[model samples]
Target chain A: MDVKPARRTDSHFVASLEKAMRVLEAFGPEQARLGLTELSIETGLDRSSVQRLTTTLHQLGYLDKDATTKRFSPSIRMTELANRYLWSDDLVKSAMPRLIDLRQALGETINFSRLDGTDIVYTARLPSSRTSYAAMIIGRRVPALNTSSGRVMLALREPGERQRAIEEWPMQRFTSQTTMDREAVKRLVEEAAETGYSIAENELQMNELALAVAVNRNGEPGGAIHCSVSGTVWTRERLREDVMPRLRDVANAIG
Target chain B: MDVKPARRTDSHFVASLEKAMRVLEAFGPEQARLGLTELSIETGLDRSSVQRLTTTLHQLGYLDKDATTKRFSPSIRMTELANRYLWSDDLVKSAMPRLIDLRQALGETINFSRLDGTDIVYTARLPSSRTSYAAMIIGRRVPALNTSSGRVMLALREPGERQRAIEEWPMQRFTSQTTMDREAVKRLVEEAAETGYSIAENELQMNELALAVAVNRNGEPGGAIHCSVSGTVWTRERLREDVMPRLRDVANAIG
Candidate 1:
């Protein structure tokens, strides 16, 4: 006879509310509009549960249903949550003007990202003349141990924590040039701690060179200011002499 | 004898889930952080309910709690929902290239807004050199009758729907120059129908001039492309001659 564990339940946790969020979270770039059955499959909820949650979300103006197809998608009202978050975030509010100034001055894609657990989530983005649609969207996350912004942010953490992240945090080979060796990554982090900036060449995107400087809030690392340019058009020496000072200035000015 | 209506209930609707959303929706620019009592007041829920919802949201990564104060605020993960919305929106995805081109060409603030009920919600925003933080934020709503983008979108609707909107939708006098009279607003909508573009000067902002053209999807009015410039620097005649054609081109280029 096999012993089974009881389902986890807590007095303070609302399981149904989490289920409802799963319905909304089911929508992504690949799974945009989903029929009830597809939603159930994607969310791993029973058909009946999916139906009730989708209905409730639709009625609350968070999800939109197509009248003809009966498929469900996230409504524009969903942006309201993001709007609230952006407005309430003091770091993002203070960084916007400086980010815009940097964008105008550099004529390259500028991004502001903050450390979230083991990832860096892009809080704001200012696209240049040739930026792609995918790059322009906010809220995209990248591994903290594999990118310039992430390394810069990690460089400011306590030594013990930074060591733990370098050893334990996951790293993906986003491109052929991505440094997968732990010793190489550790040296990069140490260099960032010494120089106050980090550079990753062709790490995330092919032919892209990224430079980042950490933004401090009350003497703690809050986020990083990043500028990415085509590796074909920029060299490390030129980037350091010409762009590093401006990036440092903007990052320092941010809260 | 007094009779009170019983609380409405439906099998398909999850009341607890809606209540959970109410907790998240309570945070705004002014009400960023909220204690248990404040959240209960703002959400109109009992203390215990607020606590459960906040705890669930915090554990689920939607809300953040201060270490010492124990107050709750929305977390950066909230942007993930907005990200899903933007990625799944067909109108926004198709309009990005044209909107970006228009922004670069004109060197002013560019917005893409879609009609949602009686209001227009800005789904995307590209800032100019002088654009403010408030102006750059996406997901802000403006009335359909007062804004140039709103009026252009309204102009493309059926006459009956248009009439109802002009008469029934709420209007706010954001600036002294806002057109408050229903008949005058009707004329502006009619003019938009005739001219294929609409312009509103000093309506929402004191020194701002806005011009918009509707973007069509499958031969139906989908959204609008907007360009706003300093009123002092632009005249109606100059805007019409220099900017209207470019706006029209971009609007037409979008799906």
Candidate 2:
């Protein structure tokens, strides 16, 4: 006889609350606004549930309904919640000054990111004096295997978790330099763990170079500080030999 | 015979959704993380309901639980949602480049804000090169009556709504220059409506000066863009003669 493991459900979890949050999550950068039907389809909730959740969210100041289009989009109050985190969250507060200094030292865009499941989300960004093709918006999400920050963060995870992620994460080829094979990706992650830093050259975008070092709080990886520059400005040797030290220093200060 | 007006409740409104959102709102900069009992007290929900809602929120990735203390806090996913608004929302996307230009032109901080209830929330902020004591984090909330952006946005509201807001808004004195008298605030808002601009000097902060103009989309107020500088650097005369026109031009470009 074959048996399957039972699913676990915490008795305290509210089903309605999860459904309501799912409704809000259905709206994103591509779909900034959605009508009730679209929301229903995206969240896999019925029309009545979507209507009820969206209406309640509107009343709570999270969703704004356009009168003409009759579509719901995130309201400004949503920003307030995030702003509170950026302002008061310990990790951001600790890293911001150092991140600014890193930007000044490298004359390149500086980013701070944290792992969110299999993706990395930019928590803060300081733009370079010179504009680049990369649009560094805070809260931007990218795949965990195609960026330096992701590799550093992934390497910092527990051994079992890192192995699971390496096996499960979808390795999409973003550019010619992108590594899709699991073994190559695993090698990169292991190298990051050994060297205390990670580098990505033209992995996510053409002619873009990024280096990242893990930030630790209480001796555990909290996030990462990364420096991104143009390939024309810094060759691979210079980034590894010259920039890596400064990045590690900044990470140490922040950690 | 006695008659009472009926309460407005859209048929699709969900009470659970509202309660869950309130739990999220209860965590602010002051209370960046909260325990279940504290959340219950702050949101005025029962402990069990707070637990259920917070648990569900944790599962949905909007909240994170601290392993040691079991406290709940807003997670990075919250920033992702807000970031989508800042990146993709029409008003913010249009105003940002102009706001950046305005910041460069005056060498002062520039802000984009919208009215939320009787308060104004900063939706985007571009800081000046020289930092000031004033904290200008995006999504910071302040009373509508005490800010130039607030006055400009309030002036753009429909007459009845504007009048109601003028009468109902809580007028608090931040600095001595804050307009606490309702009649005086109304006069200032009326003047802003007439001249297409607004100014607040030493109102919200003792040494800060701000000027604002409304941004319109489809011929109605979408939000307001404002410039802020130190009172020592700019007098009222200079603000009106040098800054107001440029601010108006930027607002027009954005609108």
Candidate 3:
């Protein structure tokens, strides 16, 4: 039901394949395992279609079905596709060594992300010695307008495109200190464009400050290298003097 | 073409969905991007079918197509499915804190893997400071007979199943030091059964030694926790005395 109108009309679109993917995606943190009825409800598909899709997915090794519970969860094979993506991504491959180097030098959480539609998706993450389970995970996404990496990438874009994003892209207040004002965000993007880096404080997470520099590929901004530190431990001025130069150097070293 | 005979006959099986997955999987480390003809040949499907599948996947945002080269590769959206799997997996969630603790305690690589068919696929990996890109990647599968983690899981299995795995499963020689002798591997498995831990030296890599212990879940061996060290920096006796107890403690902590 979430299929775009254009895809609905496109003859090459495989509706059943899309539905099967939806079934796999429906198993997430909140609903890790779902019975047939739950799957049908979550996917908004009828029971018969959900049954066929689940059966096909289970048979194909993408979904694991519990014998006693009859509930289905994503199988380990699902990670293989992600592995393929990681192996194939040119930006991730090129940025990894530098990201590791940055993590070692700064002893802070390092991330590489790229713009995808209206969000920035983390492609590579190297957590500091002190980090959480969620902080280390790859493939996490956030609104492009709210993250320092997103702001850096957006700042490098054409003015017209940046204006459209500022006007139209969805924005959410993740933290009390998040900058939801369009004019304020525009000023931050302008500052990033002029200074060649971006900084965000307590926007995504309270008591966290993030700094990012764009990595260029072929002449355009390919992605961003981000370093996050605890706001309680260091002041903004100290972080700028101590970390920004090294961050830029690592970003420049990457593709 | 790789569809099993049973799946081929199953009325609920979705062959087109399988074909689409195959197309996505065809893009890997060696062949990051594929033209329509290459995808057709790789997937063993005709050009028209490959074309339709690629189009469908691209429309669904799972495949990225190059405008100039007219080639397709997996998009970042593919990682979302892997993220979903990571979040849904109870074992990975439960094992993460322990794995991180072990990694910090040992200053070496740590991994959690489970058996999938004839292979053990890494579900979580925390790389040492000295590590390669391939070593850090999750979802990398190695033959269950060759890895210490795999052997530990196999050692904990029913004797009949262990014998079947030792006798029937495929084995490949990955390195000059790889233990290709079935008798030697069997002895190692038996030793693991007696010791409640497993070790492999220069088997998967020339200068690497891996140690593992089975993590039990509800009275069954759920998976194995692994710690890999440089063989040049560690001897068998030294590793046993210095590392094994801590490794076992971490493995027992996970479930």
* True-vs-predicted CA distance for residue A182, candidate 2, Å: 3.1
lDDT on C-alpha atoms for all candidate structures: 0.85, 0.77, 0.83
Q: What CAPRI grade goes to candidate 3?
A: medium
Classify candidate 1 by CAPRI docking class: medium
Residue-by-residue lDDT tens digits, candidate 1, A1-255 = 011122126778788877887788888888889999999998789999999999888877888899999999889987778888888898888888888778777778899899998998888988765666667878777789999999988999889999999999989898888989999999999999999999999888788888999987776789998988988889988888888899898887774
Candidate 1 vs 2: which has more TM-score: 1
The weakest ten consecutive residues by lDDT in model 2 chain B span B1-10
lDDT comparing candidate 3 with the true structure: 0.83
> Tens digit of lDDT per residue, candidate 1, span B94-117?
788778777777778899888888
Clashing pairs in 3: none
Give the Cα RMSD of candidate 2: 4.6
Model 1, stretches more than 4 Å misplaced?
A1-8, B1-8
What is the Å distance of residue B106 in model 2 from its true position? Answer: 5.1
Give lDDT tens digits, candidate 3, residues A126-226: 77655666666777778899989998889888899889998888888989999999999999999999998899999988888889988876756789988
TM-score winner, 1 or 3? 3
| Candidate 3 lDDT tens digits, B1-255 | 146878867777878888888898787778888999999999889998898888888887888899999999888876777777788787888778777777666778888899888899888887765666777777787889988988888998889989989988778788998988888889999999999889899888788988888987775678898888998888888778778888788777775
lDDT score of residue B13 within candidate 2: 65
